[model samples]
Target chain A: MAIVVVNVMPKPEILDPQGKAVTNAGKRLGHEGFSVRQGKRFEIEVGEVTPTVLEEVRHFAETLLANTVIESFEVCS
Target chain B: MRVGVVTFPGSLDDADARRAISLTGGEPVELWHASDDLRGVDAVILPGGFSYGDYLRCGAIARFAPVMDQIITRANQGLPVLGICNGFQILCEARLLPGALIRNQVQTFTALDQPLRVESTRTAWTSAYWEGQTITIVLKNGEGNYQADPDTIAQLEDEGRVVFRYLGNPNGSLNDIAGITNQRGNVVGLMPHPEHNVDPTITANLDGRPLFTSLADYLLGATC
Candidate 1:
């Protein structure tokens, strides 16, 4: 079986409150000058990795896994 | 008039929406997410709550439910539809309405009786209220912040499609928008739970009663 990973992140223009909260916590913990942005990762299990499979997964990521209006997704094998 | 309230898994306010419709002298029909049938209702309401456990994203999974197919088809055909809270999110995801609802800017789930001004009374759902009328309704949710592209925002403003604007600008919504309608004014989506404020016995105010009454008035006038 092959696995493909898709990562989704909030668009830069959209607010990422969770990421900001985490960054604030890091600051409280004495980690300064570093920032973090949060996103979601999805791993899809497939019988085999092929061009068609990759395309299909990309479609899934775009249509289901991520809302394109506020987020962007990347498909990785 | 008959108003249908769709109930998806984890929906908490479907009953309240139905009750509100009934109180407004309209028949209430219950629609299920797993069914494609709309039961021939004159209007449909998508109520608040976490559907499909709010998985992936709020209203994202519910947008693909079987019932949504029927709702989308009917809504595009000029059927009056109202989406509240999570329902608003579903409407955006279904592209029935412009913009997406994101997490509150403060990163907290906010619940309050929010003050809002009627921006436009041209929509099927807001015709009972006069333009610029200020009213208060129950606002409760985590992802209630509304956002859209600059062009879409401009178009909405230019067209006077903004239905409701928050008087106090809670949750950091763009232009203080609490609700909006489509170009045809048949479909509207808002983050506040108007159904929760319809009954004065249960709630302290009846500010939401006008929303249901407005739909009833529209349907009655349409049939006349």
Candidate 2:
């Protein structure tokens, strides 16, 4: 079995409160001068990995897994 | 007039929306999100709630529901539709409305009586109110920040399609926009629970009654 992973993150111009909160938490934990942005990861298991399958997963990531309005997504096999 | 209120799996305010419609003397039709039929209602209302558990994102999964397919088709044909709170998120996801609603800047769920200025009284939903009228209604949501690209914001402003503006900017929405209408003025999306303020017995504020009355008047072909 092969798995395809998709990573989705908020667009740069959009505000990500969850990411800001995580950065602040990291600061409280003594990690300074670091910024973090939260995002989502989805793994799709398939019988076999192929170009066609990767394209299909990319389509799903664009249309459903991530909202293009406030998000950007990347697909990897 | 018949106004259909859609009820998705996690829709919490469908009953309140239906009640508001009934109180306004319109027949309330219950529409199921899993079904594609709208029951031939004169108008449709997508009420507030965390539909489909708000997975992936708020209203992301719910946007693909069978009912939304019909709504998208009918709305394009000039059918009147109103989306409230989570429904607003769904509308943006479905591309019926411009922009997106993101997590609140404070990263917290907020609930309060919010004051809004009516920016436009020309849509099917706001005809009963005078332009610039201020009304207070319930505002409750965790992800209610509205964002759009600069060009779209400029166009909405130039065209006067912004239907409502927040008086105090509760959720960090762009330009303090609380609600907006489509170019055709048949569809509206807002991140406030107007239905919650319609019943006087439940809440002393009846500011939301005008929204239902506006639709009723519009359906009756009355010039408000």
Candidate 3:
């Protein structure tokens, strides 16, 4: 079995209210000259890693793991 | 006419949707998310709430429910389907509708009586209203902001498929689009809850009554 990790984030063009609010709070707390973007990370445990399994994971990532309209996802091995 | 209202486990507005249909003189059939059967209802309503506990993104998980698979098949066959608020989110997630709904621009949940103009009367749900008519309905959601690529927006505009446009920007939706219909006009998704405004006893006005009545009329017309 292999572990698959995926990261999902709001598209850069879209307004991310959560990220902005966090940036503001950081500024208030004296963390200066830095910004943060919030996103999600999912770790999955699957059977043997093969090209076919990887392709299936990619399909699921595009269609279900992330909504391409406003968000993007990246699959990491 | 009979309208089916499907209730996801956390649906908050299923009862309201059912009541709206009953008040409009249509039989209301209740369907469950786990069930694959549609019970042969003429139309369907996916009422609003935090389905699947709003986990992994709003409507993301609910879109894969067993019932939604059948809903998608029937919707493609031209069954009249309406998705409100969280239901709208689910529709987008399911790819039954275009675009996506993200967090509100204000970074908080917004709840208000949102005013909107009927942009088109060509849809199965908005046929009772004349073009350019204005009405108010309840809009409430944490992730109500709608987004889509520019080309898709142009297509929706060029086709005159936008069903409702906000009178004022409530959640920073692009083009002020409060509601939209698919190319076939059989499916619609909107952020506002028309069901909340259907009964005068619950609300002061009945701006939403027309939507239910419109469907009832359309179904009756189809049978004749």
- lDDT tens per residue, model 1, B1-224: 88999999999999999999888889999999999999999999999999999999999999999999989999999899999999999999999999999989978999999999999999899998999899999999999999998899999999999999999987989999999999999999999998988786897899998889898778878889
TM-score of each: 0.98, 0.98, 0.97
Candidate 1 C-alpha error for residue B140, in Å: 0.5
Candidate 3 residue lDDT tens string, B35-136: 999998999999999998999889999999999999999999989999999999998898888998888888889999999999998888999999999999
lDDT of 3 by residue, A1-77 (tens): 79988899988988888998999999999998868889989887889778887788889888888888888898888
Instruction: Give the 10-residue window scoring lowest on summed lDDT in candidate 3 chain B.
Output: B214-223
User: What is the C-alpha local distance difference test score of candidate 3?
Assistant: 0.90
Candidate 2 lDDT: 0.93
Lowest lDDT 10-mer window, candidate 2 chain B? B215-224
Model 2: residues >4 Å from true position, as ranges? B222-224
RMSD of 3: 1.2
Clashing residue pairs found in predicted model 3: none
C-alpha lDDT values of all predictions = 0.93, 0.93, 0.90
Task: Look at candidate 2 and tell me the lDDT of residue B63.
Answer: 94
Q: State which candidate, 2 or 3, has the greater lDDT.
A: 2
lDDT per residue for candidate 2 within B16-71, as digits (tens), equals 99999999889999999999989988899999999999888999998999999999
Pick by TM-score: 1 or 3, better one: 1
